[model samples]
Structure formats: C-alpha cells, structure tokens
Target: MEAVVFDGNKLKLSYEKNYPKPEILDDDDVIVEVHYAGICGTDLHIIHGEFPAIKTKPIALGHESSGVIHAVGKNSVYKVGQKVAIDPNKACNLCDFCHKGNYQYCLTAGINSTIGIWKDGGWAQYVRVPQQQIFALPDEITTEQAGLCEPYSCVSHGFNRASPLKVGERILVLGAGIIGNLWITTLHHHGHREVTVSEMNLTRLDIVKRLETGYRLVTPDVLAKENTTYDVIIDCTGVGKVMEISFNYLREGGKYVLFGCCPPAHTTSLNPFQIYNKELTIIGVKINPFSFPSAISWLKAMGSRYVDYHKLGVKTYALSEYADAMEDLKKGSVAKAVFKVVKD
Candidate 1:
C-alpha cells in the first residue's frame, strides 16, 4: 500500500509505494480502507518538529479521515464495508479523567494518544484502529464530508466549553481557516446572528463573503483601529502575537476561547491585573471529547447547502500529490486541503 510517512529527520513527508498493510491486532480492532484524509495544521507542526514529545518517527500522518471498513475483528461491533469517520482520539478507560467523562484529558492516554500522532494513521490506503474510535456515517453524509468530522468535532467541543452564547451578544472569531469557518457555520446553525470574523488573508475573507453567511469581515489592522469589542472572542490563529492581542477585543466578564494549537515552545505574556479586574474567563480547548456524535447530528441537520458553503476554497488531491497539497497549504492558497485516497 502507498503511504505518506514522516521519518522525523526531515521537514517533509515521504511517499512510499510499498508500505505494509495494517492487520487487526486485537479482538476490538478494525481495518479501514481510507477514502479521504484531511491535511491539518497540526500535521504541519509535526513535520516541522514542533511536537517532539508526542510524535513517533516513521508514522503515517493523518487523523481527520473517512473510510470504509475493510475488515473487522470478531469482537468488533462494526461490520465489513461500513462507512465511518475516524475520531482519532483514544483514552485509557481506567484513567481518572475518563471516569469523569473528560477523556481528552485522560492521564495515561489523551491528545498524544491520537491515531496519526502517536500511531500509524490514515494517510494511506488502509489504517487499523480500535472499534470504539469509528463512528458510522449517515447515508446523507458523503465520504468527503465525513473527512471533516474530526475537525468539526473539535470545534463542537470548544463551543461546549464556551457555552451559553446569549441572545444579542456579539461574537468574534479571529481567523478564517477551516476551524474558524466551521465555528461560524455552527454558530449560525444554532441561531447566533451577531458574528464577526477577523482575517488577514483577503482570499479567505472573500470566500467567507461569497458564502453570504452574514458575518462581518475585517482585516486585523482595521479591527484594531476601530476600537470594537466583542462579548465573546475566539482565537483560532494559534499565533502568539494574535493570542496576546485578542484580549483587547474581549469585553469585561467575557469569555476568550483558545481553539487553535500553538507551538509548544511559543509563549505569550498576559496581564494578571487585567484578568483580575475584568473577571474574564480564559478557556483552553484541547480536542474532541464525546462530541463526535453531536457534530455528526449537527452536520446532518445543516444539510448539504451549509456543508457546501464550508467546502468552498477546499481543494482535494490524490495521495501522489501530497507534496503539492502541502505546498498549497503552506502558501495559504487553499482554505482546506484533503487527500483523496480512494475514488469514492
């Protein structure tokens, strides 16, 4: 099988023609034939040696993927040929956090326990994962859309952490990438009307405008000059400077949701006196935790019309085009990039 492997010594991924096929190791495992796999920002971080603590060398690099079951173990509840979305997250059931239903924070295995990060994942024709990590996709959800499940689930978890978006409260999303746009769509789906987006990329800003999502778009420079504030501000850029500046736009007593993944070594300074005086809440979202089911349901309810809007500026490439896709992503030419592994 052809696979994209990260050897940990280089800054780029290597495509191999004869990667080993996955075999079912445990009774609760399933082997899936990957159809579509998303290229995430975290993947770039891993390739650049940002996540040295979690990443293992020579691992297949993909976590957001959708596929069909190629084979299932005897104890697996899933059947062969079942279409599913990969959750990627795995946790030790015995952990204290797992017992409290906060599995993403499980002590033994959590974010680092994800598929592509710590183990061989779906950047190939086939991947073997535990049965509990696969979620059956509804008939209405296409394989391409199913590839978005993992990212959408992460956004859902972020929203849950910053809950209770009251009526008439202004909301701002800083960034127009895939995760930021998903936050806009999810907010719209849930009936939040007053939302604004801040992005420096004019191309992405135009894409959001074309969708007619009714979101007010502005450049960071313009937003900073306007002296505008939001009741809730979400930072999805994951830049240290942006994270530090985002606090200026948050209202007193408002919530600041950090949904983006910053480099582990990057550090930003915050004022303790402001946090004390404003009584502001700074919430950090790790990854999806018990939110995949709700994300799927929400996607189904929103239907293709909305999903198609989210798909704008998204480009798909074959597994052989991984280098091209990564180049495009690094150039900020595409809002989202996916590798079409199978013809589906």
Candidate 2:
C-alpha cells in the first residue's frame, strides 16, 4: 500500500517495501481502507522535528482519519465495508484512566489512538485499528464530514472542560483559524450573547467577521480598551503573548481557557498580582473524551444546515501533494488542510 512515511530526516510519499498488509494483530482489531485523512497542525510539528520525544523514525502520520472497514478479526462486532470514523487514541483499558473512560490519558498511549502520529497512520490506503476505537459513521455524514470528527472533538472537549457558558456571557477566541473559528461557533450555538475573536491576519479576520454572529473584532489596541474584559476567554492561537493577553480579557470571576498547544518547553511571564486580585481560573485541556461523539451529534443536528466546511474551515489537497499541504499550514493559509486519499 502507498503510505506517507516519516523517517525523521524526510517525509515522502513512498510505497512501503514489503508493506505489512492488514492482518489480525489482535482478535479485537479491524482492518480499514483509509478514504480520507486530515493533515493537522500537530502533524506539521512532527514533520519539523518539534516532537522528538514522542516519535522516533519511519511512521505513518495522520490522526484525523475516516474510512470503511475492509475486514474484521474474530469476536468483532463490525462488518466488512462498514463506514467508520476511527478514534486514533488507543488506551490501555486496564489502566485507571482508561477504566474511567479517560483513555486519551492512558499509560500505554499509542497513536494519539491508532493511525497517524505514534503509529503507521491513515495517510495510507490501509490501516489496522482496534475495534474499540471505531465509531460507525451516521448515514447522513459523508466521508468528508467524518474527516472533521476528530478536530471538532478536540474543540468540543475544550468547551466541555470549560463548561456552563452563561447565556449572556461574552467570549474572546484568539486565532481565527479552524479551532478558533469552531470555538466561536460553539459558543454561539450554546447561546452565548456577545462573542469576540482576535486574529492578527486581516484575511482570516475578514472571513471570520463575515460570519457575523454579532461577534466583535479586537485588534491589540482594541483589546487594550481600559477596563474592558470578557466573561470567558479562549486562547486558540497558542502564542505565549496571546495567552498573556487572553488573561487580561477575563473579568474578575471569568474563566480563561487555553485550547492551543504552546511549545512544551516554552514559558510566559505574567503579573501574579492580576491573577490573584481577579481570581482568574486558568484551565487547560488535552485531547477529546466524549468530545468526538458530541461534535458529530452537534454537526448532524445542523444537517444540510451547511457551514461551508471546505471553504473557511477546509482546503483540499491530493495525497501526493503532501508538501503543498504542509506549506499551506506553515504559511497559516488554511483553516484546515486535508489530503484527500482515494479521491473520487
């Protein structure tokens, strides 16, 4: 099978020599033919050698993947040719976290669950997944829509972590990219009255502003408005400076949520007095748990209530155009860049 392999020094579209065809590695595993996969920001970081600790050499790199079950092993509940969204995070069910359904935090953490980073992922024509992580795609959801399940799940998990958005509360989402834009939509979907977004790129801001959810625009100067604050602030930009500024927008009892991944070794300087005086709550969320299912449900609820998934939120690329996709992401050119494998 053709697979996008990462071997530290280079990432290339190559045929796996003596590639291991899908076989029942475990009785509970299912073999899948990957139809579509999303190239995520984390994939970019991995390719550039930012995450040297988690990954070591030649591996398939994609987490947001959807496809059809080509085969299933013994004792499996899935049937051949069943459309499914594979959860990449495969946790050790024996672990305490897994026992509590927090599998993403499992001790034996594998490809953030199956195919993508950490293992031979979905960027290929085929992948083997544990049956437990597979969710049947609803009939109304297309292969393209299933591609969004993972990322949206991450955003939903962040919202879940910062639950109970007051109806009239105001929110500021930093970064108007995929995650940032999704945060705004989710807040509005839940009835948050006034939501604002701060983005440095005018092009991105223009797209977001046009969404016109009665959302306010905040440049650096605008955000510095004297005594101006928000009931809740979500930092999706992941920039340290933006994280710092996000705190300033939070009211005394307001909550601050950091959804973006800042450099693991990075640090930010902040005023301790402000945190103490305002009683701010700085919350951080990792990956999804019960978040993907919620995202799919929410999306399906908006059935045919299109939000232009491929326009503002997605940019399509062919499998061989991985380099172009990576470049698009590095240049901050697209909200989401997806490599369409097995194109119709």
Candidate 3:
C-alpha cells in the first residue's frame, strides 16, 4: 500500500510505494479501505514538530477520513462493505474521565490516544481501527462528505462549549480555514444569521463569497478598525497574537471560544483585571467528545441544503500528490484538502 510517512523531522517526510498494510490487531478491530482522507491543521502541526508528545517517527498522517469496511474481527458488530466515518480518538475505558463519560479527557488516552498522531492512520489505502471508532454513514452522505465527519464533530464539540447562542446574538469567527468555515456553516445551520468571518487569505475569502452563505467576510485589517463588538467571538486561528488581539472585539460579558490549537508551549497574555471586571468567559474545546453522532445526524439532516459539502472548498488530491497537497495547504490556497485514496 502506498502511504505518506513522516519521520519526525519535517524534511524527512516522503511518499512510499510499498508501505506495509495494516492488519486487525484485536478482536474488536476492523480494517477499513480508506476512500477519502482530509488533511488537518494538526497534521500540519505534526509536520512542523509542534506536537512533540504525539509525534512518532515513520507514521502515516491523517485522522479525518471516510471509508468502507474491508474486514472486521469476529467480535466486531460492523460488517464488511459498510460505509463509515471515523472518530480517531480511542479512549481507555478504565480512566477516571472515561468512567465519568468524559472520554475526551481520559487521563491515559487523552494525550497520546489519537489515530494519526500516535499510531498509523488514514493517509493510506487501508487503516485498521477499533470498531468503537467507526460511525456508519447515511446513504445520502457521499464518501467525500463523510471524510469531513471528524472536523464537523470538532465544530460540534466547540459549539457545545459555547452553547446557548441567543436568538439574535452577533457572532464573529476569526480565521477562514477548514475549521473556521465549518463553524460558519454550522452556525448558519443553527439559524444564526448575524455572523462575521475575518480572514486574511483572499482565496479563502473568495471561497466563502461563492458559498453565498450570507456571512460578512472581511480582512483582519478591516476587522481591526471596526468599533462593533460581538457577543461571542471564536478564534479559529491558533496564533497567540491574533488571540490576544481578539479580546478587544468581545462584548463585556461575552464568551471567547478558543477553537484553534495553538502550539503547546505558546502563551497569550490576558489581563486578569479585565477578566474580573468584564465577567468574561474563556471556553476551551479539546477534541470531539461524543459529538460524532450529532455531527453525522446534522449532516444527514442538512443534506446539502444548509451545508453543501461540495462547496466547502475541498480540493482533492491523490495519495501520490501528498507533497503538493501539503504545499497548497501551507500556502492557504485551499480551505480543505483531501486525499482521494480510493476512487468512489
């Protein structure tokens, strides 16, 4: 099987023609034939060595994916040929967090329990995952759309953290990358029309315009000069400077949702006095926690009406074009890039 392998060093990444195929490792494991795998910011972070705790040499890099079951263990409830979307987080059921039904914060699995980060994941033709990680995709959802389930789940989790969006609350989303755009779409799907998205990339802004999402798109420079404040501000750009500056745009009692993953060692300065005076809430969303089912359900309900997966600016590349995909992503030329691992 052909796979993109990252060997710890950023310059050591390569596409290999004969990567070993994955085999079912447990009675509850299932082997999936990956159809589409989406490249994520975390993948970029891994390449840049930002996430040292999860970095593993010679590992396949991709967690957002949709696939068909090629094989299943005897104990697995899923059948071969079942189309599914994957949740890459595998929890240690015995952990205190898991015992409390907060598996995303599982002490044992939360740090190093992701598929692409800690183990071989979907940047290949086949991947073997525990049966618990697979969610059956509705027949109406295309394989390409299913590839985005993981990201949508993250967006759902973020919304859960910032829930109770008032009837007419004004919202601002900083950054127009894949996750940011997903936030916009998800907000629109939930009937929040007064939303603004600030992004510096012209290509991404143009993509948002073409979606006809009614979102007010503005450059960061333009947004900086605006006097209006928002009830909720979500920073999807993990830059510490952007996050620090966004504080000025939040309403006094507003909430700030940190939906992006800044470097683990990075820090942003916040005034403790301002936090106390304004009574502001800072919300941090980790990875998806039991949000996959909600994401899939919402995607199925929307069915291209509220959220058109095709127009989400997904640029597809073949597995062999891994380098090109990474280059485009680095250049901010695409909102989302997916590897078409298998022909649909």
Candidate 4:
C-alpha cells in the first residue's frame, strides 16, 4: 500500500515497507480503506509549526476523511464494505466530559490524523478507526460529499451552540471562506434571509457572488461606514482586528460567535463600554460534540437545495500531488483542498 507520509513538515509518498494492512485493533476498532481526505487550515498551521507541538517526524496526516469498512472488529456493529464518514476525534468514553456527552471536551479526546500532523491519518489506502467514531453516509451522498461531513459537523456544532436564531434577524458573518460560507448556508437553511457576510478579498467575494443567493458580500471599508446593525455577528476571520471591527456592527444585546480559530497566543481588544452598556451575548465554539448525526440528517434533508455538496469546495489533486495541492491552497486558488486516495 502507498501512503502520503509527512516527515519533518514535508510531505512525500512512500511505499509501506513491511507496514501491515490496517486491521481491527480492538473490539470497538474497524479498519477502513480510505477513499478521500480533505485538507484544512489546521493542516497548514501544523506544517508551518503554528499549532501545538505535534508528531515531529514521519507520520500519516489526514483527519477529515471518508471511506469504506475494510474490516470490522469482533464486537463492532459496522459491516464490511459499508460506506462511512470518519470522525477524527477519538475520546475516552470513561472520562468525565465524555460521560456527560461532551466528548469534544474530554481530556483524552484526540485523533490519529493520518497523512496529517499527528497520528497516521487517512492520506493512505487504509486507516484504523474506532467504530464509534464512524457515521454511515446516506445513499445520496457521494464520497466527496461524505468527506465534507467532517467540516459540516463543525458548522453544525456552531449552529447548535448559537440556537434560537430569531426570524428576520440580520446576521453578519465576517470572512467569506469555507467557515463563513457554511454559516451563510446554515443560516439560510434555518430561515434567516437577512444574513450578510463581510470579506475583504475581491476574489473570495466573487466566489460568493457566483453562488447567486441573498448573501450580501461587503468589504471592510463598506462595513465601517454602513450604519446597519446586526442581531448576530459571527467572527469567522480569525483575525483580532477583524473581530474588533465587527463588534461595532452588533446591535445592542446582539449575539457574537467566535467561529474561527485564532492563533494560540493571539489576543483581540473589545470596548468595555459596549459590553457594559449594550450587554452583548458573546459565545465561542471550539469543536463538535454529537454534531455528526445532526449534520448528516440536515444534509440528507437539504440534499442539493441548500448545498451543492459536490461543489462546496475545490478538489485539485491526485494522491501524489500533495505539494501542488498545498501550494494552491496557500496561493488562495482553492477553498477546501482535497486529496484523492481511492477512485470510483
């Protein structure tokens, strides 16, 4: 078998020299033949040494992956050859957070992101995963769409965290990237028509404009001068200055969701007067917990109406073009860059 191995921040395809085929490791473990893997900003951060200290040498690197069950452990309920979406987060169910249904907060929560920065990920032909972390894809969803379930789960988690969105409320999503776009789609699905997004990049704005929806794309300069206020302001830019500027657009008592991941040491300033006088409900979403089920069900229901799951992001690499893939992403030529591991 061939795998895209990450060695010292560099990616290279290597033959499995005496590497055993993935097999069920425990009663709850299942071996999967990886089909597709999605590369995200986290992958870039890891490569640039911006993330927390991770696996330092050669390792597998994918987490957002989808594939078929190659083999199931003795006690696992999943059947062989079943199509599934992999939830990369592995948690100790015995932990306090997991016991309370907050697996994302579990102290032992982690994943073996293969072909990724940590554990061997799904950038290979086969991966070992826990049965509990897999979700069966609906028949209508393709492998590419199934792969999207991971990021969708993250978006769904954000929506769950920001519940009770008032109808007719105005929403301001700061950032026109994947996270920003997902928020727009999610808001539209839930009947919020007044959602507006702010993006400075003209290219990204053009991409959003091509979607042909009610999403209003604006530049920071426009937002700064506009007198309009929003009931919900979501900071998806992950920039401190962006967040600081977005705060002024929030209506009194409005809700603000910090949806993007900022740098570990990053900090942003907020006006204390606004907090005391206007009484804003500021919320932050970290990771998904029990969000996969809802995300799958929502995708099934929406089908192609709200999301062109097939075209949500750009796919531009064969299994071996890993370097070019990362380059395209860095150049902002692709949105959600994905690597194809298995073919149809």
RMSD per candidate (Å) reads 1.4, 2.5, 1.4, 2.7
Name model 3 segments beyond 4 Å from true: 9-11, 53-56, 306-310
lDDT of 2 at 220: 62
What is the alpha-carbon lDDT for the whole of candidate 3? 0.86
Error of 4 at 16 (Å): 8.4
Estimated TM-score per prediction? 0.96, 0.90, 0.96, 0.91
Model 4 scores what on Cα lDDT?
Answer: 0.75
lDDT of each: 0.86, 0.75, 0.86, 0.75
What is the per-residue lDDT of model 4 for residues 6-52, given as tens digits with 9 covering 90 to 100?
66545343435344566666998888888888887666666666564
lDDT of 2 by residue, 91-200 (tens): 66687887888876775764344457667778887888889889888888887778777877888888888987778887778888877877777776677758778877
Between candidates 1 and 2, the one scoring higher on TM-score is 1
Instruction: List candidate 1 stretches off by more than 4 Å.
Output: 53-56, 309-311
Expressed as tens digits, the lDDT of each residue in 1-344 for candidate 1 is 99988877665688998999999899999999999999888888888888743434687889999989999999999999889999999678897888888888886677868898878888999999999999999998887788888999998899889998786789999998877888888888888889999999988888777556788999899888887888999999988789788887877898999988998988888898888888889999998998999889877887775677345567888888998998888877788888889964
TM-score of structure candidate 1: 0.96
Score residue 171 of candidate 4 by CA lDDT.
Answer: 87
